[model samples]
Target: MQANIGTIDRALRVVAGILLIALSLFGVIGLWGWIGVVPLATGLFSFCPAYRLLGLSTCKRCQ
Candidate 1:
């Protein structure tokens, strides 16, 4: 899939994802923190299925 996430968006997602996973691992959150995997995956790949479905893209290049 094409990259639909912008640089800043990707960076935020990565940071947020890492924080969530870290919190989960540290027992600060819960198993639900594992959901961070979704953001991590989408960030790393620079693609978002939801954005695709909504016909939206944060990447200026993609637009």
Candidate 2:
């Protein structure tokens, strides 16, 4: 899939994802922390299914 997520958004997602995972690992949060995988995967893959469904594209070069 094309990258509909921009650089800043991707970075934020990655950071948030990592933070959530870390929190879970450290027992600062519960199983919900696993949800971080969503953002992490989307950030790493540069694609978000929800964004596609919403018809949003933040990519600098989208065709």
Alpha carbon lDDT of each predicted model: 0.95, 0.91
Task: Identify the candidate with maximal lDDT.
Answer: 1
Best by TM-score: 1
- Residue-wise lDDT of candidate 1 within 6-57, one digit each (tens)? 9999999999999999999999999999999999999999999999999999
The TM-score values for the models, in the order shown, are: 0.96, 0.93
Q: What is candidate 2's lDDT per residue for 1-63, written digit by digit as tens?
A: 788999999999999999999899888998899899999999999999999999997878773
Pick out the ten consecutive residues of candidate 1 with the lowest summed lDDT: 54-63
Query: What's the distance in Å from true for residue 5, model 2?
Result: 0.6
- Cα lDDT for residue 30, model 1? 90
